[model samples]
Target: MKPVRYTGLTIAWWLVGTPVSAIDVQHSSLVELEAAYAYKTGSWQKQEIVWRPEWVTRFDSGARLTVIGEGRFDAKDKLDPGRPDQPFRAQNTETVFPSDHIDLELREFYLDHYAGDAFVRLGKQQIVWGQADGLRVLDVINPLSYREFILPDVEHRRIPLWSALTEIPLETWTAQLVWIPDATVTESTLPGATYSLIPDPFGEGRLQVNRPDSLADSDFGLKLSTFQRGWDLSLNYLYHTIDDPLIRIDASGQQVLADYNRSHLVGGTASKPFGDLTLRSEVGLESKNRFQDSLTGEIINTEVGSYVIGLDYSGFSDWFISAQFFQTYRFTGTHDNGSSKEQVTVLIRHDAMNNALILEALGIYDLNNKDSLIQLEAEYSVSTNVVLRAGADLFFGDQSGTFGQFQEASRLSTGFTFSF
Candidate 1:
């Protein structure tokens, strides 16, 4: 049977087809232009422009609707080298391709309604649940896109889903429930793309992906949150298919098979502030997790626990600093991929020139692999509606490490955004 495909255009058309002649409407738009130059290849890696338009309508009964659409053009399509034959299965159904260099998509469309002390939101939207910066522990409600290899902001990398979400206030505590029917998984760069993760030692190989496409495969989660005595805390639980695929080679070693598996996740987060510093932490345990053996090509099933601790300081004027430590441990699994992994990240930001200019730096280091990534950027406000940005991404370590594998892909970039 053919796989079931969900398209954003279907929901968009349905929304537009509804009659709303007596509602209040508000509209806004933004344009972003960016380019990057690869020092290793000595060529332009990307030259892209994006336009986003948004609309919001409010009814007298307190119901609201939001719609956002995005259009992109790439003159140098190095980052998204079109996979004509396969077409990158994850987002193909929701996105439209006008040409080799142009694409259009419905970014987000949702409705917000308040019923007494409870809130309901239904449609294609993003749900975030973590406090860690540049790291994901309990934020698995939505899958991610790795087209730029985690270089873009979180808002740009996350792929929204069609879901039902509601929040209920119970005294001093709030409970959130989410039901996601969209089966879109994480999107990895294709073979010919700049940041492709698949290795082709022998030659270019075929990749076959089996995605879940039934309502029975839907995902659901629950979260309870409360604040007491200057502390913020939440408990989260989710039962869903893991977004990352487990890749294995066929017996013939000519084709790669990628499949998804289900897991039960129990996690929690806590944060508190003291004077000029804030402490934040998150912990999660996955009941069933799968990892591929590097040497034998075997898939190992095991339980995994991961945690992160972060601290943010803002004592100094016009400056903010934050640091985080993250670790993952496998309870019972083959030792080929290591039993435990450690990582650290740091971020520093400064505002200058009377808040017209800003400088920021972020660093991520893998303790086990001894590889690291450093990012530095500066932004200048040209006016109230325009902002200019420049940055550099540097990678250091061996090719076998995570960040080290992208050493050659490091580059300098500049961009601008205009909003109105």
Candidate 2:
């Protein structure tokens, strides 16, 4: 791993340049300390704990600063203590233990300035665009870490980028631009051969990943948004390196090489407010995307267009339901396996006990592959600063499909959060 250069220090130094005696402070600060713990059920039980702290400062000049820090402790070991003589297999080992031991992360450190009709933010930050849930269509600025799969909050999994973002108002419309000079791409944390959609090359003792380190691999994004009546619309464009890598087998057919391809995206989004429901939709076109052949080592180049449309209704009591239809179409070459690209996602949530308890369910079903994944969760607020949560992950259907490949990875999980 290479060292990542961030601009948080420079911004913090600039903000602290004011003299102590001449300092013109405006308001007091708010500080919060938080901790969380999660554990899985069954024999190969895995557990983790995290401590996080945050501080917010407001200045008289309409400038605000926020800082957050995190530390994680994992109790799972890579190799089972009882099976000392057995060979280490990627499917049975835990990467979080040895790789992430004593991990300390500066989750967020940013400063925001507002002037007239424009705003500017500097430092390491997460910029989210798009309105859909459980899937990403137009949110292409930041890479994500899926180390713990989908059990963690999506906001926590997003990797922040060191960038400068500016929002300018032009009459009735707003334009936003972001530039990320660091070519850092965080790949999804797939647990070797156990929960991955593809077989693990490491388990077979043949794996190689190639990464781009030059300035040309950086990213740039632009978005223009406006409102009409009760509807919000936006247009987005981004030129960046794909976070997910495509695999290419070597001539020996045993060694697999991973390559991060460069691509561009253009998309549009719309959100409308109905009587008792909210509707959201996104459409995007991706160019120069590459797919590989599993057996022949040939790379297939193709263009893909995908869209998602959904609506959320909260009319009844405390129940909220959301449903989305998502599909992708290829305009170029076809790979070895002729599979369809369509999936349906649904989310349901209910608040009970005067909003202190939440019960939620989410499902993703593949229309073509006939495979599905369902997750159920329940959370209760023990107090103003404490929360308890439990969940279960279930997969069903054919072995060659997406959700079915994780059939053996289902498990019951529980966790708690404390804040003060």
Q: Which tens-of-lDDT digit does each residue in 259-284 have in candidate 2?
A: 77878889989999898899999998
Clashing pairs in 2: none
> How do all models score by TM-score?
0.93, 0.85
User: What is the C-alpha local distance difference test score of each model?
Assistant: 0.84, 0.69
Q: How does residue 342 of candidate 2 score in lDDT? A: 87
Clashes of each: 0, 0
Which runs in model 2 stand beyond 4 Å of their true positions?
A: 1-6, 14-41, 77-101, 190-198, 202-206, 251-254
Kindly give the stretch of ten consecutive residues in candidate 1 with the minimal lDDT sum. Answer: 1-10
Whose TM-score is greatest here?
Answer: 1
What does candidate 1's lDDT look like per residue over 1-420, in tens digits?
012124443443344455544379999999999999989879888899999999998865576778888899999887767534332334433576678888777878787877788898878899999778878889988888788898888898888888889999999999999998878888777677888876554455577777877367889999999998998999999998888888777757677777888999999999999999999999999888888877776778988899999999999999999999999899976747679999999999999999999999999999999999999999999999999999999889999998998898899999999999
Give the Å error, residue 388, model 1: 0.7
